[model samples]
Target chain A: MRDPGNSGHPDQSGHGQRGSIEALQEHVDALEHQSKTTKRAHQEAMRRERQLRTHNAVLAQLSMNALREGCDEHVARREIVTAAADALNVSRVGIWLFGDDGQTLRAVELFDRQGGFARCQTVIRADRYPRYFEALRENRTLPAHDVHRDSRTKELLHDYLEPCGITSMLDAPVRIGGKLVGVICHEHIGPQREWTLDEQTFAGSMGDFVSLSLQMGKRNEMEAAIKRQREYLRQIIDISPNLVFVLDEETRFVLANKALCDLVSVPHQELIGNSAMNLIKDQEQARRLRKMDEAILRQSQLSIDCEESFTDRDGKQRWFHLIKRPITSVDGSGKQVLGVASDVTERKLYQEHLASMVRELDHRVKNNLFAVMIMAEHTAMGSNDIDEYLHAFNGRMRSMAIGHEILAKTNWQGAMLVEVINSLIRPYVGENLRHVTLDGPDVMLPARVAPAMCMMIHELITNAMQHGALSLEEGRVDVLWKVEDQTLHMNWIEHGTQDVAQFPQRGFGMELIERTAAHQLRGDAQLSFEPPGLRCELNIPLKLPADRHE
Target chain B: MRMAINAQLKDKLKDLRVLVVEDEFLAAKSLETSLRKMGCEVVGPASTVDEALAFIKSRTIDAAILDINLSPGTSEPVARALRYRNCPFVFITGYSNISVLPDDLRGCLILTKPTDPVSLAAAVGQLAEHART
Candidate 1:
């Protein structure tokens, strides 16, 4: 430690007071000079102590004001630097705080006494000034007189102190939580000033005030960060379309969104603290939801997916798929059930309809197969040769196939009678559909009836083209029908063809027509041979068979 | 032999008037032909509510046969009309399920279509015998 008392070296020639009268007179003068220096030193000490006491009181008051008003930390730090600069009568004083990592000091509040500047932001690196860094660790203050000549501060001689005309520095380390966190720097410019013991102590008190401000600033930043995160998380939850809710230990809703509120058919105020089981009428569903909740909480599992049904406000049953999980705070505040439920009623209905569609398709296939069997039997009975039988069977199959193609396109709902007629004649009509005149009232025929009617129409047209009106280019067929007394009286008249006597043998076409009328339609048939062509008029049913399901 | 017997049955049904309410045109005509062969004059084979209601308003029917499931709706109104007129009727359907009939008509004679010709003849003969009385 450098002694302040021994500074400015005692005069070495003042010790020869033992010999001459002039020497003796110089000795008396030396004694007076020593006494005057001692008195001046004593008075300076007393003045510094008074200044140190005032600085401490001001620092204490500033800290108290900061705590009471909760003002900005930088404002409190500025007040501290101003008080320090006044106490030392220094040109400038600054409070430098360590960064979070503590590798450097940030000059947070700098006050220039002459200019009265409150804050001048600056940075100091400990790595570049090893001697000052080491000195700060070892001493309360450098008391750096003639800063260019001091061992610790000479590192800043040309770069900082000398350039700025700063001849002296009184620096005191500011410690927080038992580590050196920062410093209070007092700079004297124009002339070198030896730092008194009281000035060094006063600088240390100002450093304490800055440490308090730093703690408050850090806390405020942390709180602000946490609040932002919470707001972000809450927004994400509120915007979700699913029924998001938090349930208490008793399964009462403690928090809910619009979706869950709409589910219970209640306003948010009424929904809170209400048990979900009370809203669902189904006892089994309530029990299942309760059990699932237990699984989540008791098993300490993350989440579970489940489906449940409940009656809606509209009195229709609605299905919901729930994915719920348990959430717990690390501090063990309480356990909560965080659940998200989506409406899956339409999905369930589609699945059931898909299954029924498959069943209906099965029934349709079976019914058509039975009709094919009956048609084959009649065709086989009428054929005289194998080739003839095959030809007749193939023709009948093609007619049925064409009929089903139209029905299946409509999902087996049914085909229009007109559509069935057109499909069967397309092969014979070629490019122009106008060749065959189809005139009839629109009839929505059942899927079961299309194939039979298709076959009957097929036979008439084939016979007409081969031996009747449709055989000639100019010839045309006019078909007409109407619903009268529930009987569809369809007339198939061929206009032009070669005249011939009736065949002796009744072909399958004739037999199929007469049988279908008698058995399926339960109607009578008439075949008349006029000169122009044959007229086959049959009165058939306009309704689905009693055996067919609607 | 069945034709000869059916003609003989027609002697009993001669001069009787009957109404048929069937949706299927061919089934209606086939029933009409049977009723005609039995010497019963047929009034109508109504396919819908409006047609059947019209026939009921105009005609004085002795008996009727009703198809249970008809287009536009079931034949309940026709059965109600026949009941108000004191005309005995029977229902016909290919469906074996008797549940399709209304609660009041559960006891009514219902013929399963593609029915045995003998049963149909038997039911009509019985209805004719009751009508004469």
Candidate 2:
């Protein structure tokens, strides 16, 4: 808009004006060049911003897809490679996984812009492509702008780049758990292409996405394995006959198996996290258990094997042989108690029974020893010589032994009256058993009464053998017995010793038999000499007086 | 031959009216013979707690020899009865362990079974001597 007349160079008018115009033209050209450069730079920046946006959007979508449940490894890998190839505008994009040996890289999925998705199924060995592997070992992205000239990809010039018509390559190492596991490769075709920093960064992020998905897959597999292991252990404890439970440091139930739950009359789910003290129906027992548990937790005791008794919900007493051990909790956070209890109620009863039986046997042995002592003393008193004493004492002992045998057969419950009578008389009647007739109903004589009755019967047989009917070959005897009003009535008649009918003075044997029957059996025994031989009758109460029973 | 009697306790047992409580008849007879040989007037060889208790109530029992186990139950009632009467008594039992006795009777004298006549006489003599003092 300035006028040419205001020019300082008016003196050299024409020449000066041309020079001035030239200078103005040069200034305009310089300004225009600066404007054009600024516009182009702004356009380049906008394009990069758009590319970054696209890359970020693609990565974001791929991450969300990978996170979706039921998106398997193969599906996630294909999505990642396709997204990378599309976002980066590359000819090919592939996911390569390093074998466990770390020597071979296998192409899992390759996305070809021209050919669509396919598996290159190419396995490249680290030994054959040493420089490529060495670069991957750096755990950083490698941007080989010229695939043929770049030393990192030069080894792949003939075999890979030429075959795939790739002029450039950008590879990013995939790391899982901070260890290099594989790589993501971006291959470009046509003329050599320079990889932008944004593209290299995008490649790195893709590797990260692959690592994350694979890490998630590994975690899922581990979680499933852990669940299976927990189930296996649960089944083991549930099937066990023993009551198993785990308690935390607070004495609350951390874990309880089916057996323990059933014992407490609670369900497995309901019992967990509940105080173990509540399971014991008795306060005193629970207190004692708490003390024991405390001791275990304090490490004052390593474990306890004790007999525990408690009243159950049904008010019935139950016994357990409980073994408890202090254990570190599964999370290794604090102390816990592992308890295994076996229901020993029946076993305890059996043990008590066995103890009582042993005591009873001891009592019987001592009592029998005392009885033997008395017999020896009495036999010595009544006999004139050693032979007489031995014979008589041996007979008495044999009678007692036979009685014991009968009692043993019945587990010391009782013996039948007929068996007792037959056993005593069989020794004397031997071959002439028919001559000594025994007639009686079967009566179960109590254990306490059997020995006394045996003694009486033995005395009668001895007398008959010595001087009564048994002294003669053709002698015969009739033994008949019956029970009436809980009283045992018996008559022993002899036929052959009539001439010896004169009543002999009462001997030690007769007195002992009579006294035993009268005192112990709480009964009476009478002996009379008749024309035939000897006649005896006994009346014994079947049951002892109530207070007198042992 | 008579089993030797304790020379030192023979006089204390002499003419002593001793009550014998035993269930086994033979053992009772043996105890009776031993007491009689010791120059003691033996009372009823009562076979049960009631029999012994009755004798304790009726008879002039200066000292007693009691079998701890009668049949169905222990001789705890008899021991208590004798204790109530301030009667000195010695326990004879086939059981080696006497922890079965009640608290009051645990302090009483105990003698295991198959006691020789001499020992039996001595135990009774000791009970009589303790009573005299």
Candidate 3:
């Protein structure tokens, strides 16, 4: 519209036309500018919308990952760095966490569009870049359009910004439990670029996702530890020899070990939630158990130890020493009882047997004392001198002691017939012990008759030794015995002496033999001095009639 | 005059028959000797319940000394038979406890083993005198 001919028109019409044309040109320029600005604004809005869409998708993915089971902090960090780089269209992105000392930032996961993923152990010290660190602490999001000029980022220009070819940076502080943890940094490697508000907000969200991931990782670790601990405890309980169980306040089984389950003949899983009372069939036992359980629940008793008897599947009664203690329930419902029972059946039986043995011993000791008194009085009666009396009394007492020693071998139950004869005859025929031969079928004397029989045998031996065949050099005694018709029939014969009828009856030994056999043993004895050196025949009842002392 | 007084005491006991039931032969002989010394005619030194019981049934017994423990059985039956006949008896036992005697016989005089001969004679004399009354 502006030409050489148009410049000559200085008239009012020409001036008016020039003014209108200028105005129209100005209006066209304005319209074109308006259209161009609108196009730029539309492009900017679309870019932001795309960035937001990426952020939303990435955040949704990160949130899902954070919620996933066993998603650790490292995996979560990788996801954040990769997602941030992609959303912001930046080449390099990394997540750095503050060390425990709060003086250093260490890169946990670093991602680059060109390199895909890189292992970075890069650390930035707070003392080295105090300005940058302070900015991070003070600001939720630090946006530096010019890395060398921004007061918040200038400290990084010499080493970080220049070396990495990073002209711009957008970083968001990571916080966990209301404390600053670290930062998620998006670095632009090309010419200086501005960080948009939408991008800054997206960075903040990534930092939040990191916090959640850290928490999730910690929770996963705790859960795994708890599971392992529970399994370990289960194993320990199962292997225990004692019956073990945990019962709730209602007396229902909350936990039952293999020992308890095996005892009840029930499956472990099946025992839980069942009443402990149901396991015991006896009404009286179950009632007592319930009373104890109630007392424990009421806190009146801290623990109880009691003996209980249970009839097993074989119909044999088994005793158990049971211990129950109150414990705080893990489920937090109420107090519970932890019970352990040890089988004590054998121990109880042993204790009863020991008591019976002691009673038998008491009876024997008293009876033996009476026998001693009788022997002392009798010995004194027969002796003309104190020395003679002492010798006889000592011999009698020794004979009694030998018999007791033999009986003690069998716990005083009985003495074998052969053993009794050998023990009594051995002392008198010391060098000739083997010469005094005993021939008899094996027999056991009742404890009641043993000591008296010993005394009778002692008297016979004394008479033979003092005056009969035993006094001669080549003298020997032959004893033979047999069991017949429930009677111990024994015969004693002396050899190597011709003067059988000259047997001395000066001492009371001969009379004592006859008297003991008749009175104490309830038996009979016959002595004849005619034939083979004063042969004596004895007969005693093997099993005394109606002498059950018990 | 002393001889006459002794004879008079002897006459009081001369016809009194005492029974001795002891399980131990020596102890039984001692009892019989003690009773005989006191001028009492001795019936038996029975070492068993059956022997003593048989003597109580057949022999004339005015007083008795019974050893409580016999080998096969106790002298309780003999004491019972003697008491039934109104013949007074004293129990000689190795057991120190009188509780070993039956409830009916626990009231009787009890002499533990190792008792003196004088006490045995005195017990028999007292039992004989009591029985006559």
Candidate 4:
């Protein structure tokens, strides 16, 4: 029984050894197949890593170039989108930014690999792309592995990407100061692909580059706006005609416009930091200005016609009419005084001159009235008959009245000699000047001399009417005057009335003419009774003292 | 003449004392004769501010006739005194321009110069009326 069992065991042992060797060979073959699969996957990952590194380098170069060219945010965004698309080997790239109203995402840049880039459409219609909008609001990257799987993204991807042949998409949010400003995305149109971690990281870097460009662009725009506003204000201040000045709360000159500097004859630099009162020559005016400044400090508006006299840089006194106003801060908590001044020196002087003229005119009129009264009394005393006295008085008054009319026309300074002579001789020109000869230099006589000359001329004419040139139709009276060495020589000659008396007794008319021409004027007169008639000549200086002449 | 008889019988207005403030010599002399003929005693015909003021203080004046404008300026002093003493006075001026007339004396009688005997007599008569009142 022992010999038969041993022979069965040897065959079983040999079969079991052969089975174990075959199973080990099968296990080794399976492990070799898995090793080949793992090596292929690792090589594919390394190839993707190198591609991403190259894409990142290209993106960095594009960003640096865009910045050096001073590209604005829109241009910089477009450049970054195109570079990212080329690096990722994609067909389209786009950048969408949050609008002022934070709920919407507006497309800012769009690039296509085959054709030129198109301007970003203003209407991305964020409401229609719910999944994409949620991704942006959450500030998370959304890489779609299969566009057809997610129902929320399927409609947008199918409608927007299917026609363009796009299958995969990668989107990353651009953050600034921990806030999502926009998103950068790349779309692949050739084949359905999954986004690797490297592609996502590159997209994130692009988002960062866009955020920096936008911030810089906004800062530049703000600075330019501020500069333009300052230049406009400076132009207005320089070209204004009225003097403009700004004073601090301490009453010191903070700024003076060009007009104000020219007005005060001081340089703008000299005026700044100086006490405003230093320009004022009059102490009283300075005190008033200080009070006005105090009022401004209290935030009260003041308007006054202030007469200020200033000593200019040349030490010349100039008068100005100052109008001060207060400029208050927006909240009315602080105030600065603004003053505008206009020169009124000439106007004030003209007013003074006019007033003095009026005073002098009044005095002349009173003196003339006195002369009229005296003449009336003397004429009345001279005549025996009432009719003769009345006639003489009326005639003299008429002549005096004519003088008044002339004085009135000239504001009582004087009358033109030609005007006075013409007025006096107008009534008698046909009757007397036709036969009489009148000649004189063109001269202006003072108001005082006019009355006396008028009276004398009347008396001479009356005498000729009664007994000289006017007495005979062929008779003539020659009157002339000349300015010789500043002396006025007046001649009255009568060359008629041969049969008239050689000389009549001195009468009131003769007395008046003599007294007025000689005593009053401090001049000399000669009266001769020639065979023809009576001749008279008078000589006087051109300028006379007021009392002597008046 | 009636004027001569009036001048001789000066006793009627001998006690009627009057103050005369005038600047001109000729005008003042004529006024003095006219007043004397009307039988009034002339207190003075002062020529200046000081003289007029001194005469006003020294005299017992019943009435006064003042020239509105003296040589230097106006007769404001005489007007003020006459107003203080409650005395009546008439203003005499050569011209009708009386802008310089004192505010207090605006209501007083104004006599134009080279006045006739009748006007002088009437102005004096009015002063007598004021005195009686």
Candidate 5:
């Protein structure tokens, strides 16, 4: 409250007035100074606010850039190093990852403000720098203005600090899934730089970014490895000749090899997702196949080496030896069945055919034995003495045995018609087989025909020995047969016979020839009676009698 | 001694007339001799099914011996012919099992031949005695 008339200048007032005016001027100056100081402080605070907003924007952009692409975890790591240096405005920045042992810290990446990121070789030994390592293990960030003097970092004084002229460092631990994996280092050069709270926080954020990128990188690596392993297994299964397959509970095919597809006569793409029931055309066999699969599904383990058979669309029997194992997901949520199968159709059919053949052999042997017993008894009756019986029985038995030998050699399928004639005459013929000539177009006769023909040949040879060709040294019997008009016309001609003796009566040979021809061979037998010696002609049908077995 | 035994053997079927119906020629010849030695008059030794049936139809047979399967057919028709004449006969077959015979001749005294001499004589002697009664 100064007087309104009083001048505000000290020179305009007397001593007291002057002193009061000076005091007032001093107060005014002090107030003006205070006002300017307040305005400057306000401006300083506004500039700092603008700077902090710029840093936030830059860091946010850096973070987004670091996570730009998936499976780019390592790429993101390199980005983190470069971005950290740029964001903090530091000369050098490095990331160190702890090895598995956790004692040695090897630098993974390094970035210079002047140079881009490069592979690093910086390693810190935890054992050698005990205090420093311990301090870092306990604290999250170690911001040092004087790195060489800080107890948490003094181990770098002589070797790292003096050499590179680094006066300050800010480090933050990068943790992933609650495990400390690595550390990010912000190193300042030349002057010892005092780290502000903003710079410290930024460094800590970079640590978080590093740990995330590393975890992401490991995940990407694991996924790629899994993908590669799955492909290898798929290739192995596809190329294998074994019918490899997978199925769901519905009996639908989930996956099958080319072998399975080809066996079912369907293309690979069309075969998948098809039911097993659709592949089998036979209802009886299809039911059996379904029973086996249902049993496997019911037993939640493995069903190994079971044989299954079914008929295909072509009316051919198909056989498989199958093995199935149930596979479940780790969580036990999904059910899949793995199957390996072998095609055993040929083996199974061969066994069945062999069994039928064995039965046929049994029936044939029994009938043949019956015929032999009758033959032996009748031949005995024909015999005047035991010597006659032995001689005739031996000859008949020899012919029968030789016929069986030829048949056995041919697996009982049939004997050649000429071979049958030759086999019976083999024992009777002298060394060369030329005495008894068997002539015909080579025809094969079934097993049933062989025995009847053998008995006929036996009777003829017996007659030849007694009354016909071979009775004389010079006489020869020529057996010539021809297939004419679907009939076997065989003529037995006795040659070089000096005595043209006619038969006194129709004997056993004639009667037997007639019986065998008419009943067994379904043919006609004629004794021409041109006899100087016997001339018998047999007109046998080319095909066997329908019920010849009886 | 041999002459005495043959005489005794001949007298066993003295005045007996027997028919031999066998298909096998040698078997018929052997059987004819066997019947003759027993002092029985031999009838036709037919070698076929028709021959056997014809002999039975034409002749007055005392007792008959029939082979079951005379080739070209079974001895069924021959058996029917013998039965029509009220003739008692025995069957000689290669089949040992009696079940395999025709239903008409299932229980007929069937013997597996070459005929057992004792059985053939006994059967014929019994038939001869039955004829006398």
Candidate 6:
């Protein structure tokens, strides 16, 4: 309309042109507003992209720190859980392990938002969280945008996460050697949040670190256990009382305890490389021991009650009861002989000493019985009265008892000659005729010789008292003996007898004296009557039976 | 008849020479008398190792009778000499156990005392016959 007529051209044209220009201006303003909006949206997108990259870089740095501190499995798991919780902005983080039976997942570690860990208070049984256990057992990641939405996971989520104010959850399983060991879970509250692929990948990597650290920790525990067991066995073997030794197949000593060193009277360092037979006292015995060792090697085990005399460091003989057995190695590939020995020297000596004592006791009892027999026979021959026989028997037994007492003092070997003479002659000595004299060389006779000599001396003393010099107030007697060329010559001279007379017949006393001095001792005797008293002389062989001599 | 008996004794004594090894004087004298009565000639009554060794070197003995134990120990030297000469011998011992006998003398003729005259004569005759064979 404004451009329709030319008459109103100036006014209409200006007004129309103003209107058109204003319209153009408004269009231009709308186009500029649209371009500015597009530019600002692009700038905001670039800023958000840079922020996400920084978060990813921080997560990578945290994961590297967790791996670097993996010396301790517990500390590494805690660091990983805490780092994951902070990255995801969650309230709590936990690591749960699937039980070996595959029915349960138990919490291994737990971390709160404040970076503090609760150990015993935060364990979750898998029965209460079936979905979580299934995901871990299947070795699959579980992403729950709204934990309360899934009926299968609602109660479990509530039981495991509600107390800790968790509403959304992200979980990844940790695997080692192709087996599902545990899971790493991050819990968030209030609303569901989108989980990015990068965040899920980062969580999985942290799970791998936890797996390797746990495996290493278990291996270290096993090694420590083995070390403790070895030390215990070594202590037991070192403190054993008996002489325990181990020898190689070549008969060389390989191991010996302190007791073995003390037994051989050598240091442990000196005994190790030496042959076992070197401890034997005799060379011939050593040869036999070598044969025994050979036999033991051929046959896997051998037990022998060997009488071996071992020479100590000072060359003293010690006896042992050695027990050796072959020890097969655990794998049955190697063989060693284990030898144990016990000292038996004292027991052997005691047995020998006891045997000697028994033989001596038997000899003494027989001699005493023989003396009683002689006394009974002589008394019966001298007088017919029973009273006289009893008195004489009593006196003879008393004298025999005295001899036995002296023998006991000398261990039944022999009695001293002077002691016997003094005891036998003491009863007959008087103030005026106290001239009982004894002269002889010192002689140690056997048990057999001492008793025979005692009886002989007793008879001579009795005869001197009843019928010879001791019958008078001024009587005297001299007893003397000397050993020459293995012959004992004894003389008994008596003085102050009433008269010297030749015996018409052999009386019981004379027969007793002659038989005892000759037959019992294997000697000779000669008795003669002199002017003042009676003289008796006897010769006896001094050598005894060979067995009884030593 | 007496002369005939004497002739028989002479015949028994003709080649019977013996060596007696004993340490005890009484026992040796008794053995000598018994050997003479049996019509055997006794060559020696050697008491020790040296005397027995000398007698063996000097004389020819048909048979030997030895006491197992001499002064020191078992009469091993005399036994060894008798074996060397291949002479027949018998061991007279006071002990019944034979473990102490020399290894070579084991299972040989061993007579225990106190020996009777008849057994002694028989043993000597048997040993002599074995030697002759």
lDDT of each: 0.74, 0.85, 0.81, 0.72, 0.74, 0.70
lDDT of 4 by residue, B8-59 (tens): 2344345578788876433565577678778778987775557778987888
Highest lDDT: which candidate?
Answer: 2
Question: For candidate 6, lDDT tens digit of each residue in A164-220?
Answer: 666777788778887877778877777777666666665666677678667767766
Q: Could you estimate the TM-score for every candidate? A: 0.58, 0.78, 0.68, 0.62, 0.69, 0.51
| Better candidate number, 3 or 6, judged by DockQ | 3
Candidate 6 per-residue C-alpha lDDT over B14-73 given as tens digits, one digit per residue, 9 for 90 to 100 = 567888887543345446656766778897777665677888899988888887766445
| Model 1, CA-based lDDT | 0.74
Task: List where candidate 5 sits over 4 angstroms from the true fold.
Answer: A1-73, A232-244, A254-258, A265-307, A313-315, A321-326, A334-347, A432-434, A438-443, A481-491, A502-533, A536-550, B1-133
Residue-wise C-alpha lDDT for candidate 3, range A1-550, written one tens digit per residue: 6753345445766677877789889989999999999999999899878878877988888778755778777887787788788888898998888899988888888899999888776678889998898888888899999888999899888867788889899988888877888888899998889888888888888778877888888898899999999999999999997888889988999999898888778897799999988878899999999999988888899999999999876678989999999988996777999899998999999998887667555655665775687678778888889998998899999989988898789877788878877788777776557557788888999876787688778887877787666777777788889889888999999887686467666356777777778777778889877644878899888677777543
- Ten-residue segment with the worst summed lDDT in candidate 4 chain A? A541-550
* Predictions: Cα RMSD each: 12.2, 5.4, 8.0, 10.5, 9.4, 11.4
> Clashes per prediction?
4, 3, 0, 0, 1, 0
- Per-residue lDDT of model 5, residues A359-423, tens digit only: 55654565456456656766776788999899988887787787888878887667887877766
Q: Report the number of the highest-DockQ candidate.
A: 2
Ranked candidates, highest DockQ first: 2, 3, 6, 1, 5, 4
Task: Write model 1 residue lDDT over A1-550, tens digit each, in one string.
Answer: 9944334424633443233447658878999999999999999888867876787777677768754455677777777777677767899987777887888888776788877766445467889888998888777677888897899999877666766678899888877786888888899997778776777777766666667777777777777888899778767876776788877778888888877777667998888889877887778878888887777777566789888777888888888898899988334787778888899999999998897677556544654564566556566766789997897778788998988788779877778888888878877777686667888898876665666688888888777766677777877788888878766888988776555563224566776677566544556678877767788998877663354454
Q: For candidate 6, list the clashing residue pairs, or say none.
A: none
**Chain A TM-score of each model, in the order shown?**
0.63, 0.75, 0.75, 0.70, 0.79, 0.53
Taking chain A of model 5 alone, its TM-score versus the true chain A equals 0.79
Task: DockQ winner between 4 and 6, please give it.
Answer: 6
Candidate 5 residue lDDT tens string, B11-102: 55786778777654445655776677677889877766676777777877878888776544667787787787788888887555456576
State in Å the error of residue A139, model 6.
Answer: 3.4
Clash list (residue pairs), candidate 2: A549-B72, A550-B71, A550-B72
Which model is ahead, 3 or 5, in terms of DockQ?
Answer: 3
TM-score of 2: 0.78
Q: What is the lDDT of residue B116 in candidate 3?
A: 65
User: What's the ranking of the predictions by TM-score, best on top?
Assistant: 2, 5, 3, 4, 1, 6
